[model samples]
Target: MNAPTGKELEQARSSAQENHRALHRRISRLSDDAIDLILRDARSHYAWKDQPIADSVLHELYDITINGPTSMNTLPARFVFVKTPEGKARLAKSLKPQNVPKMMGAPVTAIIAHDMDFWKELPFLFPHEDRRHLFDGNPEYCADTAYRNGTLQGAYFMIAARALGLDVGAMSGFSNAIVDEEFFAGTTLKSNFLCNIGYADETALFQKLPRFPFDKVCSFA
Candidate 1:
């Protein structure tokens, strides 16, 4: 797809700002359809249409999701978009049997991971102070923080994809060891999960399952 024109970008920014204000000011609740598009009625799709997503849209998805919060803005998440047959073949060896077809059918699958040495970039991402020293010698702390923030970023990725008119199917049933060997051989990164992205095949959707009520999962502190 072609890049958005300057005028189009400005219009999109203005519309987004207006929507943000409206949402915060309670001028209007999100339309039910809009809510359904992103959350209320979203589903974990197992089947996908043959349509391909544009590179520009994939870039936009990352641009939007990168703004999500992280501890000390550590921003540990790293993504590998596996789209080609060769890439999918490499990933296939790591996937569970039931997840194989889903990954192979989708147009793209994201290998979401975290950099264990994320603190090395603190000088740039968290420039206020020398926070690198905090995790310099602490392997346990670094691992925990990387995994936690990386997983959060993966959630942001799914949300961003949904907002941009795509469907998502996130799964954890993969062999981390094989994936790491195949993809992160020389890097300090470790796999957290995999998420498939594409247009959904609505006819293949399973029935929506029930969710826990607020009273059952929340507390009045």
Candidate 2:
């Protein structure tokens, strides 16, 4: 596929903005199919079909994911989409042997990371208030806020992928130190986890794993 030109991308962005506006006008809750697509039927895929994901789709996924709320509107997460052979090779160095096959099979392996200096962006990301001051001279507070909010964004990314008819498999079976050194060297970004995104090979999946019943895990406050 040809790369999108600057003009084409701008046009796409304009169309996407209008589409998002239209979505806001719908006040009703999602139907059962939507529920299934986003969660109920979604599985952590360990294998993938031999297909490719376009960059435009990734852009749309990110656009949706960022709309999720974060503490003080501090969007602390950064993502590296590994699609090239070299990129995937470097990423494989961090994965456990059991996880390597699945990661390499994925069309894109996203390195979800948190910027330790995310507070510095608050002047623009959260311009309505001076929340950056809340982290001044406090390394622990900065670390906590970044990691917490970054993880939320990573989860949001997976949901957004599912909403776009893509499958995701999130994994922690990797060495963060290796990932950080390979992909984010000399930066404040710290790797949180890696997630594979693509069309899944359903035939390779085992039956859905059991989950705790609502009654077992939930209670009215």
Candidate 3:
């Protein structure tokens, strides 16, 4: 597809804004099929175009994802944008042998991470009593909160990408320790997952994977 012209890009943004407004109005009322499309049709996309996923789009994506929830609102997810060659090289070291090609080939990959010391600011994020003390003696609480909230934010990233007509390939097949040491250095952040963001190449998709039957996967109780 041709690159969108200035006018064309603005028009697209206007259209997207309108759609966002419409979706926001009925946030909890999405049809079952629409919700399924968001979950089921969402795939771990790999192939990408030569065109970049612009900085403006990344900003919009963050604006959408930070709206997601967390226990006591302790939003601990941190994102590292791996766009530069040096940065990509760092990420490449941790990727599994099978994931190397895709990670290297994608236009951009986001390193979703969790901050181990996130509770330090509980006075700001939790604010109800000295909740920071709740996590001080128990490191597992920090681990659990980071893992759960980071995963939720990662899922939000995928949904926000789809909402903006972009595709993502999210993967966990990487060495977390290597990533933490190489990219995050001395920071408290632990790597959670990698998400490749860009337009799709449908021709490269394999056959769709099967899903478990609802009867087997869900129960009213």
lDDT of 3 at 122: 78
Candidate whose lDDT is highest: 1
RMSD in order of candidates:
7.1, 7.7, 10.5
What stretches of model 3 exceed 4 Å from their correct place?
Answer: 1-28, 31-37
Model 2 local distance difference test score: 0.92
Clashes of 2: 0
lDDT per model vs. reference:
0.94, 0.92, 0.84
Q: What lDDT tens digits, residue by residue, belong to model 1 across residues 87-131?
A: 999999999999999999999999999999999998888765678
TM-score of each: 0.87, 0.88, 0.83
Q: Report the lDDT of model 2 for residue 31.
A: 85
Candidate order (lDDT): 1, 2, 3
Better of 1 and 2 by TM-score: 2
TM-score: model 2 vs. ground truth? 0.88
Candidate 3: give the clashing pairs.
Answer: none
lDDT of 2 by residue, 1-221 (tens): 24345898789779999987888777457889989998988899999999999999999999999999999888999999999999999999999999999999999999999999999988788655667778988999999999999999999999999999999999999999999999999999999999999999998889898999999999998
The residue-by-residue lDDT of candidate 3 on 1-221, one tens digit each, is: 14355888799879989998998887957777766656756676767777788899999999998888888788889998898899888889898888987777778899999898888877776543567877897999889988998899888888987877788899889999999999888778899999988887776799888889989989995
